[model samples]
Target: MLSSSGRGPSLVRSAILLAIAALVATFFTAPAAQAADGQISGLAGKCVDVAGASNANGTPVQLYDCNGSGAQRWSNPGDGTLRALGKCLDVSGNSTADGALVHLWDCTGAANQRWLVSGANDIVNPQANKCLDVQNRSSANGARLQIWTCTGQSNQKWNAPASGGGGNPQPGGFVVSEAQFNQMFPGRNSFYSYSGLTAALSAYPAFANTGSDTVKRQEAAAFLANVSHETGGLVHVVEQNTANYPHYCDTSQSYGCPAGQAAYYGRGPIQLSWNFNYKAAGDALGINLLNNPWLVQNDAAVAWKTGLWYWNTQNGPGTMTPHNAMVNQAGFGQTIRSINGSLECDGRNPAQVQSRINNYQRFTQILGTTPGGNLYC
Candidate 1:
């Protein structure tokens, strides 16, 4: 377990690798679903095609609807090779560069077509050491499919059937299809670290969904990262008090408040504070917030749930335009600014804020893109 403050560039890389390893282990721990019936849930409506058009080596393959045709009927072949329509799904010529095109070719026992199936949403190709990437790493539909280096991006994840199909059921019991799962959980790893962050999305219905919305996994992970960085991983604390409480502090009336009226604000996960937020969490969880504002820190699950409530309520990173914010750091520096400006009612040090901005910029650079823009706190 690495602390956020201690996570330098090298540590971040290690964390990413550790996350990948955890996902791989989880994938193997789950049993493979029966594909003998050819009844795949997610791929039923998607297209498939033969690689390379030649059914030979180095030919480009395309995706087309399944018509019981040999070209569309694929087999895992239990040898890391996908055999379908007498061809294999491959990375064109085994190239590992970014933006590499995927093609169909004859199966020669190469590693490109050999995939490790996790749930319905994630797949692993060992040869190129990457996952099948969705263009632009977006969650929108109709995005093109390609291969890219795996950095646990949401676009590369695919979900397979749970071993015994006994996990919690999503909104619908229908299991997410492999292709659809990949769309939701696209990347090399599927698990995210849960520590001090108030919003741990690991338990979100969106990430656990076995159907359509499961592709929002990356969004969930991003939310967790944003909140973790914002709140000092449960270290920083806030103060809580109700306006109606007897002897409450009011500058116009009294300078000294009653002992019971002033209480420590809830800490950790969602930073639960104010009567409104407590009430919201209470309503959502069917608890009485007025009686127990401390539930946030005392209950881990409740804390995380409150955090998700904020994330969902706010449009998240998508709320504002990237250009207006500059560098599009989203929840990172912007959140700190918000806290300091509104809550602290104190000016934040420009140097400290800029340092955080630099950290976020470096993070995005490692992932290979300039994130949209910064959310100016």
Candidate 2:
């Protein structure tokens, strides 16, 4: 990744994006409950619904008029997460903050994704340590559902089917949804497609729901912070310095740049540049990026995957990959050292390193985590 004086804004925006995107839910095993069917009615007797009756991940779970529709039917499976339409009732982004939206998602065993019926009027989400709330206590139709401090208000009350609660709570693995992804980037939803990215993470057992909150947040924060500096919060799919584009091809290699000299320019979330990097990324991702470098800008998931591959593998200027720096308690500064330490670390370029640190600090806070010390290389 290359950074110039102009890269300052990239770090800032990347921090904002990471802070929000890291809110995606983390999964853990929970006890399962027997499935029971009924309507879960809340404020004004409105029914909890799978918006548009769509059984898709990140489908908005809202309060709608009760019309004896299938969308209103729910099952309280003992696994802690409420079930309807074969999907789990989830807290958007695993957010504990007041007013975080609720949605129906593929059930993951993560704590935030789990819900328990108190058998009273309250529907409790153990992960958030809050109660399901009707936005602003509005009793009107289409009021959005959110997580708020537990209150004994009628809006917080719920009526579900009676059950001693038997079906095993299937493990809800870590997977990013369209809704959660959008919340992470806020304004950059259209910048990259997330389906492939989400699927890739889900399919990778080693990287999916495999750590504690601190470890998870730190890893994600560290990775995105670096990439944000590289691509400017994914604002640019390719490098802006067009003059430097053609120079990325190293002719000395046994095999010359197959995509042509100018083709191997900086691109994607990590701004992958050089023919060697394109070839390596393409080989790992099972794509022909070396011969077709433009895929980085054309495919959002592919772009994200390439970035992740670098974070997880490359040692660069540091002794360990950025992923290891965070998970091993090596501190965020090490990650900076790993990415572009030669250019910015050891007081070489304090401005650039500080910019990356600023983003890292903000992201950790937004993730409800503390930024460990030694933030500067």
lDDT of 2 by residue, 235-316 (tens): 6777787877777787876778887888877777777777777776676556788889888888777787777666655666
300 in model 1: Cα distance from truth in Å?
2.8
Worst 10 residues of 2 by lDDT: 12-21
lDDT of 1: 0.39
- Candidate 1 lDDT tens digits, 1-377: 11121211111100111111011101111224443333222332343445333566655544344355555455554444555556766777666455667767766665455554443344555343345666675443334456654434455554332333322222322132344333422331222223322133322222222112322232333343344344543334332323323322222323222223433244444454434445444554455654576666565655665665444332222222111112122444344332232221134355545544554444344333443443345
Residue 276 alpha-carbon offset, candidate 1, angstroms: 1.9
List where candidate 2 sits over 4 angstroms from the true fold. 2-184, 202-204
| Model number with the top TM-score | 2
In order, what lDDT does every prediction score? 0.39, 0.64
